[model samples]
Target: MSMIKKRRMIEIQQLQDDSEKQNVTRFILEALPQWFGILEAREEYITESVNKMFFCAYDQDRPIGFLYLKETGKDTIELFVMGVLQEFHRKGIGRALFYRAKRAAREKGYSFIQVKTVKMGIYEEYDRTNQFYQSLGFKEFQVFPMLWGESNPCQIYVMTL
Candidate 1:
């Protein structure tokens, strides 16, 4: 007899309510220390304005990853946060969320999608993050020193489609 194995399914959906907001914020806070040198309590204000939020990579209905995107202007979108639960990292969930964000941007008629990352600090993952964006066709467009604060230098990248 042959046995069949089922593959895990992932679903991406916009966060639609207060309950989802809490879940998404919690996920970001949990992932922030590893990616951001310092996590600020005030960042929740930005999260609350997430124009587009994606919940991705679920295992039997349990969320394993999420992405938060915000609009910068009429024709611009910014990737605010994208992260996967620790157990689900390196499984392509991040990339999937990225593509979804791009598609959303395109649908909204955004000419450019921008992402900002710290240029230096304990956040060495910024390099990898920048490379990942470049791999997805985004290019370095600008660099702002102390953009987020007195100590954080930000590198801005833009993808034109």
Candidate 2:
């Protein structure tokens, strides 16, 4: 049997409109099942904050992924959240989104980009996720146990450019 190939039609661009915002939020909600309970902040709050400086990935005019960054300090930026539609995972969309975020951070004069992840039983893909960041040159700065709360231990990583 012959397999049909899916074209890689991904495009990266800054999320600038309300429709894009809704698409991103919906994608996040669908991609991250545990976000509602584990994350202390509301999705809308995070989306609004990130919308101020965010980039999205679209495939064939459909929003497929997003990467959000925020200036945390004078020379530092935080990668708040990044995810691709579940079906679109493992298709290089994450890497493309990351590069876009990094470019934006560099443009903003940030010297470092940071990300934090929690160590929870539900996050079996943590190792893979961390490895992906490290592959992109991020270094582990700190790993705090139960930092967010009694049950949420976190691993903080940073990439210096």
lDDT of 2 by residue, 16-46 (tens): 6766665675666565665434444545535
Whole-model alpha-carbon lDDT for candidate 2? 0.75
State how far residue 116 of model 2 sits from its true place (Å). Answer: 0.5
The clash count of every prediction, one per candidate, is: 0, 0
Q: How do the residues 31-106 of candidate 1 rate in per-residue lDDT, one tens digit apiece?
A: 6566633546426633564445544556676777777677889888888766677677667878887887788778
Q: Which residue ranges in model 1 land beyond 4 Å of their true spot?
A: 1-6, 36-53, 120-122, 149-151
* Per-candidate alpha-carbon RMSD to the true structure: 2.9, 2.9
Candidate 2 clash pair list: none
Candidate 1: C-alpha lDDT: 0.70
77: Cα error in model 1, Å: 0.9
